[model samples]
Target chain A: MTSFVGPELTNPRAERVKAVRALSGRSMRQRTGRYLVEGPQAVREVVRFASVHELYVTAAAADRYSDVISDAHERGLPVHLASDEVVAAMSPDAQGLVAVANVSSATLDDVLASRPTLVAILASVRDPGNAGAVIRAADAAGADAVVLTLESVDVHNPKTIRATAGSLFHLPVVTGIALDTVTDALRAAGLAVLAADGSGAHDLDDLLDVAGPAGAGDRSAAPDLAAPTAWVFGNEAWGLPAHELELADAVVRVPIRGQAESLNLATAAAVCLYASARAQR
Target chain B: MTSFVGPELTNPRAERVKAVRALSGRSMRQRTGRYLVEGPQAVREVVRFASVHELYVTAAAADRYSDVISDAHERGLPVHLASDEVVAAMSPDAQGLVAVANVSSATLDDVLASRPTLVAILASVRDPGNAGAVIRAADAAGADAVVLTLESVDVHNPKTIRATAGSLFHLPVVTGIALDTVTDALRAAGLAVLAADGSGAHDLDDLLDVAGPAGAGDRSAAPDLAAPTAWVFGNEAWGLPAHELELADAVVRVPIRGQAESLNLATAAAVCLYASARAQR
Candidate 1:
């Protein structure tokens, strides 16, 4: 049976605790090569999937999420039992459990080598929640991978991780690549790169209707949904700039039947991804 | 041309400013029957689509958003030009523009009387952002209206208003209705009620496959997406309760082809609503 290791970390102001908490900042995360995964759900996922270094939890939290502790111990990861005050000092949003994990990611070239059929690329999407939501949606839609441009929010940011709801560990997310580079590489790998924007020439529904063998006549106007495809979603505020829009093979708009100006970044991404997944199936 | 109505408001600590700031509180809003709409986008919408009580903007913001002010004036609205500090004090996130508008909504009966073809119901969804995002998606899907159960977050919450991104004024949102009443009423109005859950017996994509007249076999088990329909989305954390699920004619699950446990509330709602919207079209 796995048990708590080491003496109880009782000091809230300890240097180790401070270092762990400091991972919340980008500089600290970069210098230490580690990031914080807060809350039971995320901590469990990190322990199960990522290369986790350590874990800290209060006595009650250990009791509540016994399986998490058991799993961590099974992985030979150090599990520290800390005082409630110490855990509180670690993170207010952690719900009494947190972990220090290495900042890990898959490279674009590596992911492209696998010849992924469905991919989602986020361009300059800085909002952590929006970025994380899109990642989760992409995963749910059966996308092979998600690529975030260099300007996008950090996937390891606590808010982004939390928004992902453990889905961060479910899929391969490629980060630190430029948008143009990503489009070029994916296109070379035999995938149609489509951009989602309000000003798109084709409506998403019309494309869905003409999808698969059901579509007849001149199909040159629209990209095939059954083929390998990648969707590029712009920032939450200003949509894809004209130069970026031109990078895609074709631009498709989610049909707006009501008076809404547009759907939020995450929702629109989900719609487009699901539509493609449906057609491919 | 309509210009600033009177002397500029110069005092950030003035009673009027504090009164406006206090509108952010639920008690204050309930007492005054008004809610705060922050940012130029929302303020412009409130001025155009709702009964606005007051407009507060700095001279710079007024000049930049001259159309919002011009439209407000055209509607016989009293516009107040305030100092930067004064406007900031009124609401920090307003971006130099804010409005006070009456808290308005439609009754369930009234919405049903219009013979709506599509509707979205949020059941016990306490997250304001989730509630607002669903409303925006519903509007985008061309749903006739949105209904929030009594236990749902107040639609007038500033965070909710911000999440809607000005779509709050585009469609009628009915609040304070119970889930049972919403389901019963919508079903009676000739709309099939569907509850979205992870453990649903019917897969959403399969239903879409067999939707409309294209199916050769008996379609009695599945709810037709092309028919008038209402979708009930559960809370973000805990999905619909057993009693709530029992109210729907059919329970549908969004297919999860990846390791992602589930899609977030808003994205799932958007996918389902868009599916229905496409089928209906």
Candidate 2:
């Protein structure tokens, strides 16, 4: 394990304050190659999921979450004590824990290699919560990985991380991949690409039938849980864009029999992912 | 159309600085009997789902969202235009729309009378997102209403409302009912008490079999979406407590075959509710 310590600052209105605030802005977060995560739960997930470059905690929270600090320290992460004001200056809802980690964005190529793929690609999921919830669901469904488009919310955003429920650390999450490229890569890998659309040509279960074990019938006696498959979820507001719809091998719906409009992005993704897992198994 | 004219404040800090900051404190939210909502989408949802007692929009936002204001007015809701600072004061993330609605916490008795006769009870869900998602799922699944234990997150919490995706307005949500009373009430209605648990004795499909339009083989063929039934979801963190589990006539699991620990609370609820709707339809 390796550790690197940065210089400490006493000023509440120091140069780093601007940088910290920059994290809230999309451009700044991307340019700086860092995204801020707040609260104990999020901080813990970051530590468990990604390698941390810096750790900050208020004296009180540091005392309260000693185990977390020690875990980070054990991983040789630099641990620092920031005055409560300092932490507050960095984030309005810091929850007394902050960490700076290297942002590792995934690509279409990376997702292709993962086995038993339970992938969720947000074509244009705008809401941070929806994007976050889908990512969380992808992680929960034990998908091989998750991928988000350029139009999707940043996976490192605090809200998205919180929605992931620490599953962010459990799997590889790729972002900024063009839908066409992902479609091609998935096809090349022999993985079926299933898109979730409210008015698709086929029901979701049909696609599950093609990709799942039992549905495959006599071709294979036992359902294979590790079958290569990817499930795509559309935008939180508009759902999958038309151009991206063409990218999917199949477009399946969750089958909303009632008058209700649609399931939330995360909920939809969960049903799709779980359905695939059930089919393959 | 009836329009509401209310207090006007110009100072951004004057309105949100206290409420936004105060919202972080559970005690303050409890004391005020009001919670904050941000952004146009959520504000729109509030007007549609929950009673919008007071709506505050910036002059620019009011001009931009005049139709929304008119819509709210048509519903007899009061919409107020304030300085950006005033809106900002109440919600740091005001994003052009913000509101403080009178919190209405319903009891199980109020929600039980709906025509659909299908209801959901959350035993001990803690995450506001999970709680809200379930409410939204219940709305989508055509469940007449939703009831939760006191231990669940406050439905009025902004996070919960946002999770509901505006379904909160159309659905009757009751909270703080005891587990025993809830089970007893549902049983009295002749509704089967199906509890969703990881170790559920019966599979979800089994229940769907019994409720199906094609018939579960035991009954005459007749699909009834309006059947009297109650679907229960347990705590996100620790699932249903043992005592509450005892109240269920049948405990059913969603059947997760993946390596993922468990489906998220709201996702699990959606699966169960949708399955029920599938059977009835």
Candidate 3:
């Protein structure tokens, strides 16, 4: 954490303000190796768990979320109390609280070393909101880690961070790996690789029926939930291509009892993750 | 469906185009009793299922989505081919296809008459995307219908319609009803009203363990899945208040094995609905 604590920043057009605001763009974020964490909830999480370069808060926001500022101070992080206009200028949607965090430190190797029982893998998921929702759902399902394929949306996107509801800081999120590499690594790590797709032989309900000890009643060839598993979710629009779908040991579809062409990516991911969580229990 | 077919609309500022664009706002929709449906997927579904007032498209779009146009023509709906500028002026997100449809014909009483085995109730949900996602998830789970309390986001919001991914046309959506009335009506219809809250007394997994005939283990007082049930989800930010929580017969919580505070409204709704769908199977 930077120790550049200073008096109240009253100038909205200050170079520091412009620098922080620039992080909202992809090129600026890459050049500075920093990303914007907006609003009180996300800013709080970053302050507590990530390497926050600086924290900007308005006096009103400072009073409202005192714990966040206090925690940041306790962690030896710079907490800048900026004017309302100055804070808003940095990021309009930040609610007067913003944090500049370094790029992620999480890697697939580190996550694999922990021997995760359940994992969520997003392959080419383009929607930031969808990706964030899946991460939050994965965390709720007690997943050990989440991996985003190379073609997926950037995990550091501000929209994705907001969508995670602070769960972004709760678990390891490995990004920028190829889909095939992710499937191979998770499988090699002794976890079954299951891809969530509309075209699949296994019905999720049937898998639930024979999962765990008491229900391991018969099907010898069925993918068993007794072992650790990783689920790969495809893009929000096109879904998994044949090659990507072929990477997993099995492709499973969440059954649609009604006439919906398909459930949106996030909801489908939630159902699949929760099912796996229940089965592995 | 109206038969107001005429020459291709060439002017972007035409009164017809202005009127179609105006339907995107709430007041215009209320005054005209019509809402805008954008994109080919939604336009197709509205044409097939709802009372579509008119259809607008560009020549290239009509060629790309010929089936949509053919179906609308067969249904005797007015099909207006507009220039690219005119179509874009009608609704930028429409991607060259747009439709104006009457407000929902779905009513709670009509839904009740069908003896719905499963239903989802949204209370004071402000986010249009969350409302639509819940509706879509409920439809995918085979829920008979969806109901939104009077305080919830308008289901006709273009964002909400798009979030539904066309599921809005697949099932009945009852809106503008109070939460208490919705609960009471569903309960009287022989369905157990369960409120999804983080402070619930019953764990969803524990309930699932004893659900269905095969696993009807012990737990006599636990809510059973053998009978019809209705789930009520609270707002996205502030969950159910004490008074609202008191309206349900029981409260059930989705187990959070990880550190997430709570699941997002839509994802949480999906988990609960799918669990019910699985158990009721």
Candidate 4:
């Protein structure tokens, strides 16, 4: 075991911690192409994803998570011992583990070139949790890609990343692509573009019924699950902006017969994405 | 305009603001049988629901909402001017209007005596938003009542109330009941108890299908719509406790073919509730 570091120590043995703290902001995250992970859960996920550029553990936590630390260390990942003060300063809810990893930063061209079948486009989603959940849902639905408009919350935001439950590391999520480009590219790919609208013309169940089973044996009867399709989700407050809705091949609403005015943005996105998955099944 | 003159304002005219601020907590809310409404939107909702005990608005907000305030006042409700300081102290996000309204508490007797067809039982749900959304969904699905387990978050929590989008005022939401009493009473009422589990033996869709349509012309094929049925949603953190699961007549799960472990609690509840509504429809 490494010699016990004094708990009160506050020397900068690693410059990466500072770099990571700076990445907390949107500008810094964009510039550095790095994102921060906080607490034991996120740290464990980062280790599983094995994309850790730098890892910081409090001396006490290091003792507790020696296995995780050693695994990352074996991969030549930089490991630093942070004083409790440092950890507290770095994480609002520090459960004694933190890590920073470079984001995948996949491009739209890369996603389109793959001839993706299932995809989700988020236009101006504001909540970090919703943004993260959409990406996570997109990943779960086996979407070939997730595209984000410029106005959407940064996927790398700590809250957003946490909400993804580490699926963000696995999913091919791309941001800053204009809605027009996405719509045209989807059209070019022969994929139907469906937007989730609060006041949509058709019921979501109807769309799913038409799409057929995601993994149905009867190819002719199925809506062709392998055929490229993009499910678009909008912001929680105002929903999909009208201009973006114009690009949709079909507008669908999740039939909410309930008194709840709206579902949480993330929940709505999940329902839509899952509907697509169920339909294509 | 009536002048405020409560403990909140040094000036006698600010008493109205003091009364509104006093309703922030449960004890005070119960004492006065009143609760505080925050934001212009919530005030509008309060007015629409016809439960506004008193209305308080800042000068600027009153100017913008003169029609709304005047209408409520013409209905013989008191409209008072709250200084900016009063509204700020009353509601952090006052958004220019606040209202003090009678607490619309629903009791078990109130729920059962109504002869509800569909009821949702919330078992220890801790998140305000989740609880509020569930209640709102219950309202949307036309559920007769929402029963909360003893440990569940307060339905009247501002965040939960706000999440309901004013459905709290409209919906018959009951809390502070023992699990056994509520479950047994529901059973006695001839309501089949269906609990939502993340990995239940039955899929939600399948359960809905098996239940058949409510009130179909063929009496043998479909259950009567007026027959009582209760759907149970568990806590957000740990989900339905094992013992609670055993109490349920049947367990149902929303199938997830994706990588996500589970849907958010509110989303899961909404889906299940909506599925039941759809089956009945």
Candidate 5:
């Protein structure tokens, strides 16, 4: 691994700093085909799973998290030490570490080609935090992939990446596709598309019961959770439109057993995905 | 209902505006025994369930949400029409509406006095957003009350209130009590105290299985969810301490079904509470 024996980058206005900062914006990210992953956990994940073009760390942070730097260097990725100000200027939420990764764009065909048993399709979900949390939940549920429709929030937004808590690297995340295309592709892959909404007729628990035992052992009498399925979540404020719901095979709701009117998008996703995971297991 | 015929509050420096704005801080809230509830949803809940000292709305919002204003007026609460600038200065998140509500304080005795069937006890959970989400989840699960220990985040915090999405008013939220006191009181009330932690020995689903069917039909052999139960959640970062976990009747873990290491605090609470809600139902 080649080591840099140069002084730490102190100039916040340096071309390198400006370029890294530019990744925070949509136009620049699109033009450069690179995005920034901030904080130690996200940076480590990007280094491990994706092609990280550059790694930046504060001098003190370099000492604190030497393993990640050395690991990145071992992979022939350059590690640059920068002043805290430079790091802050690049991304205020970096917490002393950042990485510039090549935008690993995946298409509907790329994700569907894997024959995913379980997938999460988000339609017009505008909240970046909610979108990222859903991605994290899907990863935790061992979903094969996550599909964000063209109308959904940009997955490359730093807020979304941070909210994913590094799960963005655990599985394939396909974005910028039409919802109809996603539903059709999943159906073509032999997966049932279930839309999750509060107003749905079928309750999630009832659906789980119909999906048979939590384990994959008994699948003769009832539909198995092991069956390939895709869960489509809609926008936070206004859930799946009538057209979107019509595209799904079934619509399911997480029953509110109490005074609460409904569950937030992320929490609902977690419950739905975990239910499927438990059944499949 | 009394009609507010006074000139619209146009001065941002008005005493009424300053008093309402002061409620945003913890010290001011404590001193005045009042807290600010912003946005339409939360303001409506505070008006319905809690005591509102004063209601402020932009002229447009007054016309837009006449139902809430008229309802508040019907309940003998004064509604004041203010300019957009005044409402904005009071709280940027008001969305043209805000309410100054008398802080409704409840104790462990007050909560347990009601013979709560299901309770959520938060121990030292400091993040306002997480705490609020937990409260909302508890409400959705139909829990009777939420107990926040002295070390937990203040329930009166505006961020916490906003995060609750009006669930804060749907149920009694008791705060600033000792964890030991809460545990003892819950146990005395014949409620099983279950601490939720990732490192726990018992899997949550297994516990649910032992808790009998999702419905309350067969309660002879298993510990039915209809029986009184209290769930104790710990801090966000460290989770429950050994001593805190020891206070519980059982420690439960939501099994990690996939590669993601752990679920966030709010999502975990949602899953746990909903599991109980489903079982009880």
Candidate 6:
């Protein structure tokens, strides 16, 4: 690995620093075809999974995370040593490490081309934090991909990326597609699209019952969770509208055993995704 | 009902306003023995389940949420009209409604005295948001109570209260108890304490399989979720210590089917609580 012995970039208003700071905004990210990944966990994942256009690290952070710097340089990616002020200027939440990476141009068609067995479709999910948490849950559930419809929060939002906790780099996440398009594509792929909502006719427990136990023999008698499936989560406040629910094969509700009116989007997504993961595994 | 034609308080520095604002801080909350509940949902819940010391609403809010005002008056609670500035000073997220309510003095002994069938114990959870989400999940799962160790986040933190999404009033949440005391008391009460951690001897799926379906006959043949049980969730970042995990009867792991390193504390708690809910119901 080539040693990155370059002088540390201390000027916060440097031309390169301004460009990196601009990546924090949506229009700039879209225009430049790049996004910022902050913190070591996110930076590490981005470097490993996506093409890192450039890596920035404070001198102290560089020493603390030499492996990351070496790995980036070994990948033929430039590693810049930035001062603490420069790092802070890019993103306050960045723990002395940040990276500018090219945003993936993967489309829904590209993701579906792999015939994903399990997918998460977010329809009109507005909160960046919730969207990212759902993506993390989907990644933990081993879902093949995550689809954010046109109205969903931007996947490149910094808060969303932070909430993903590095899972954003672990799986394919397609964004900006229409909800109808996603449902049709997943259905055509032979995956059952289940809408998660409180007013659903079916209970999650009943669905799991029909799916049988994980790794059980005579699985053919069960609902076949091993079969391709997609879970469509709705907006946080209003949840899935009637038309949206109608698009799915069935609407499933996580049974509220207590007085809680409903689960939040991310928690609901976690329970639903984990249920599918348990059944499929 | 008595008519509330009281003069509207417009000053942000009003004594009542300062008192409500002081509830936002922990020391003030402890000194005054009261806390602030913001938003219509939280304020409504406080009026219904807890004793409201005072209810403050802006003119527009009073018009929008006349039901809440009427309910508070019906409950013999004082209702005061405040300027938007005063309400904003108390809490920017109050949505024109805020309430000062006496803090619940419920103890671990009081909670266990009811012979809780299912409970959630939080050990050293630091994040207010995570703590609130766990409480919400526990409420959704029909947990009888929630226990937070001394090391855990303050249950009355405004952010934590908001995170609970009004579920904070749905159940009894006992805080500031020692972890050892909680586990010991739970065990003495004949409740099996299950520590939820990534590293565990038993898989959640296997445990669920043993629990069988909800409302199934011959629950004695399987692990009966209807039986008294307590699930202990750890901190957000480092999770439970080895000593803490060993205190429980068994350590259970939520199987990670995907490439994700692990689930967030709140999501994991949701899955664990729901599993118990499904088996119990």
| B-chain TM-scores per prediction | 0.97, 0.85, 0.96, 0.85, 0.93, 0.93
Candidate with top TM-score is 1
The per-residue C-alpha lDDT of model 3 at residue B61 equals 89
Question: What digit string (tens of lDDT, one per residue) describes model 4 on residues B1-281?
Answer: 53333322324235655666778777887787777788876677678764778776787888887766866766677776756776787788887788877766689888888987789999988888788877877776678789888998876668887888777766677888888788888888877777888768777655544555444434343333223579888887788888998887767788765556666776677667766665665
- Tens-digit per-residue lDDT, B1-281, candidate 6: 33554888889987878878889999999998899999999998888878778888998998888888989988988888888999998998999999999998578888888889899999999999999999999999899999999998888999999999888988999988999899999989988788999898778888787674463445334344555779999989999999999888878888887778889989999999998887777
Which regions of candidate 3 deviate over 4 angstroms?
A1-4, A213-220, B1-4, B213-220
Candidate 5 Cα outliers beyond 4 Å, as residue runs: A5-7, A213-226, B213-227
What is the C-alpha local distance difference test score of each model? 0.91, 0.72, 0.89, 0.73, 0.85, 0.87
**Native contacts retained, all candidates in order:** 0.91, 0.38, 0.87, 0.33, 0.66, 0.76
Q: Is candidate 1 or candidate 2 better by DockQ?
A: 1
Tell me the tens digit of each residue's lDDT in model 3 across A1-281. Answer: 22236789999999989999999888998798999999998988888877888889888888888889888889888788789999999999989899989886599899989999999999999999999999999999999999999888888888999999888899999988888888888888988888889898999889888787664434446777666889989999999999998898888999998878899999999999999999888
TM-score, chain A, candidate 1: 0.97
Q: What is the interface root-mean-square deviation of candidate 2?
A: 2.7
- Candidate 5 chain A weakest ten by summed lDDT: A215-224
The TM-score, computed over Cα atoms with residue i paired to residue i, of candidate 6 is: 0.94
> What is each candidate's DockQ, to 2 decimals?
0.89, 0.31, 0.87, 0.39, 0.68, 0.78
Residue A182 displacement (Å), model 4: 1.4
Candidate 2 similarity to native, TM-score: 0.70
For candidate 6, the per-residue lDDT at A59 reads 77
Candidate 6 clashing pairs, residues 3+ apart or interchain: none
What digit string (tens of lDDT, one per residue) describes model 2 on residues A122-211?
A: 786778777766666676566788877777777777677767766676678788877777777876777777788897767654444355
Q: Tell me, by DockQ, which candidate is best.
A: 1
Q: What is the C-alpha local distance difference test score of candidate 2? A: 0.72
Question: lDDT tens string, model 4, A60-133?
Answer: 89888888787776677767777887776777666777888887778988988898778889988888877886
CA displacement after TM-score superposition, residue B77 of candidate 1 (Å): 1.4
Off by over 4 Å in 6: A212-226, B212-226
C-alpha lDDT (0 to 100) for residue B273 of candidate 3? 95
- Tens-digit lDDT string for candidate 2 (B222-248): 323225668888888788867888897
- In model 4, the Cα lDDT at residue A216 comes to 42
